[model samples]
Target: MKQIINTKFAKNIFLSALALFSTVTIMAQEEDTSSKFSLSGSIDAYYRTTFKDGGDATTATPTSFANQTGFALGMANLIGTYEMGKTGVVVDLVFGPRGTEATFNNDILNGVINQAYAYWNVSDKTTLTVGRFNTWVGYEVIAPAANFNYSVSYLFSNGPFSHLGAKADFALSDDVSLMLAITNPWDTNDISASGTYAVGGQLGVYGQFLNAYYDGGGQGGLGFEIDYTGGFDISEDFFFGINAAYNSNSETDSGFYGAAIYPQFTTSESFAIGLRGEYFAATQDGFDDVPVTALTLTGSFTKENLILKPEIRLDSFGSDNEPFLNSNGEATNSLSSFALAAIYSF
Candidate 1:
């Protein structure tokens, strides 16, 4: 496992350097002075307090964000993009608990490089990308800067995070495109513990008011997952979105499936309110199927490059579900929490 991981790392670095050299050389011959390098990212932090009487309720929340009491650092992310004509590279690095949990699995290399990828435009309509990149599965992104709500949803929490491999993106038309990729096993952020790969991709359609996307893949002996996401601009000030996903692990003989909906309304240039409702379930032998449902209401206020998000969330478990602990340390079926977060982007 260690040898394979080392070799993969070396290969990734080698390919990135080689591609950069070749592309830059080609661009130099063409005398394309349009090449540019840019830097951007965000810094975020939050405070959370559970309404429960008993325990911290951090574990009861069952999702990302506000894991600790009082104040917590969400993350400090830095992304650099370099483009020289048809070739480009993106390097994203992150730190803090939010970054650690979102980008890394286990404790290895936590809060390091979230994604590092190189891309080449093979033609006007096709492009190739290699290295580690974020997954195209869910509607909400890993970055807080790209999300409407400050907290994460159950769907995003349970789905694949990122993949490391090679991918090809094809622009079929003005409003349609296709992506195909073969990547290391799910959530293998830096290395593949299984020493295997999986195939997956996304098919997307973009319209004036509606957009739809689907992505899925299966690992050799691990499992399979498929996710669908859609969004509609109901009006200039209102928007709606939905996400559904299913994943099955053959090794554990268990499966997980869920769906979520998002609705938002902008009342003014500085304030917007959004709501997320989600249902999630886990299936395994000896336990009856009971789904978990959650609803989150978020209000976002923006001032220049700074944004504040105040959110309230309630989660309920089915009658047979006992995943949460009550204030007195008793098994419970429901949990509620509140959080306030701030983000600065440039």
Candidate 2:
């Protein structure tokens, strides 16, 4: 009886051990296949005032964001990301003035959906992405936290903001990469009324990119645009960036061309100063070319996840075109402004 009882006890122990090992192995496999989800975003606001003869706050800079007088809200950006093995998804949402302007072409969710895309890693050197994504043509993005200056430039304001379609990214070599995309016409977020589409390509060598875009020329199509965006680190504390683009519409015989340079100097880990000089021009079939020269100086201070930017900007347009008014409400060809912005990121 003692031998039989001891044998039963041993068998029970062996079964329990097996069960425990199986449970651990299952848990390890689950951990390896589990997906990762993350949330990140930013919020920003600014106070702006003009420095012209009339000190008119109404006639601020003609750019996209931070144009409202006195205190104004920039936007709240929320980005959610999910990653599992070789596949991942990103959903970026935004709210407020800046978001509204950036997504002006979105018909359904007007200012809410900034970017929603899914990507799959096809191989070690290639990836495929589908859905809507931010345009890869510009040096500066729509997010205020991503830009050194509180205000935007003409090139960014007029360029395509986002695209909806499919793209392939290829890593040609350690330093060379290529991207090709086909999408609905520029800024057509929901659907294309004209049933037209666009194609874009980008070649990257080192950190510079040569980007090109073309669409079927029609009433509302963006005919073609070629852009070059790049930056160089001059020293440990100084950096220089450049952006140049030419856009033309064959149907309308109208388009714009512009170039801008950014020079920044970091004083410390928390503070930096930057300058942007731009020359932009517009051409129409019958109208004379209208050109504008703009200069902006900005200082950035950072603490933790919060950033403070104080900026001064000046714009001078051609004498033939007076788009701004002075303190006396008279036509003028120049405008100057000052702004202080606060941005918090997480």
TM-score, predicted candidate 1 vs. hidden true structure = 0.85
Q: Which residue segments of model 2 deviate by more than 4 Å?
A: 1-32, 286-288
The sequence of per-residue lDDT tens digits that candidate 2 reaches over residues 1-346 is 0011133343354346445544554454455676799999999999988867746734766778788978999999999998766667899999999998888835448679999987776578988777789999888999999999989999998889898877889999999999998777778878755556677899999999999988774226578899999999999999999999999877777889999999999999999999999999988994547799999999999999999999999999999988888878888899988889999999
The TM-score obtained by model 2 is 0.89
- Candidate 1 lDDT for residue 66: 55
Top candidate, metric lDDT: 2
Alpha-carbon lDDT, every model: 0.76, 0.84
| TM-score of every prediction relative to native | 0.85, 0.89
Report how far residue 101 has shifted in candidate 1, in Å.
Answer: 1.0
**C-alpha lDDT (0 to 100) for residue 14 of candidate 2:** 38
In Å, residue 55's CA in model 1 sits off its true spot by 8.7
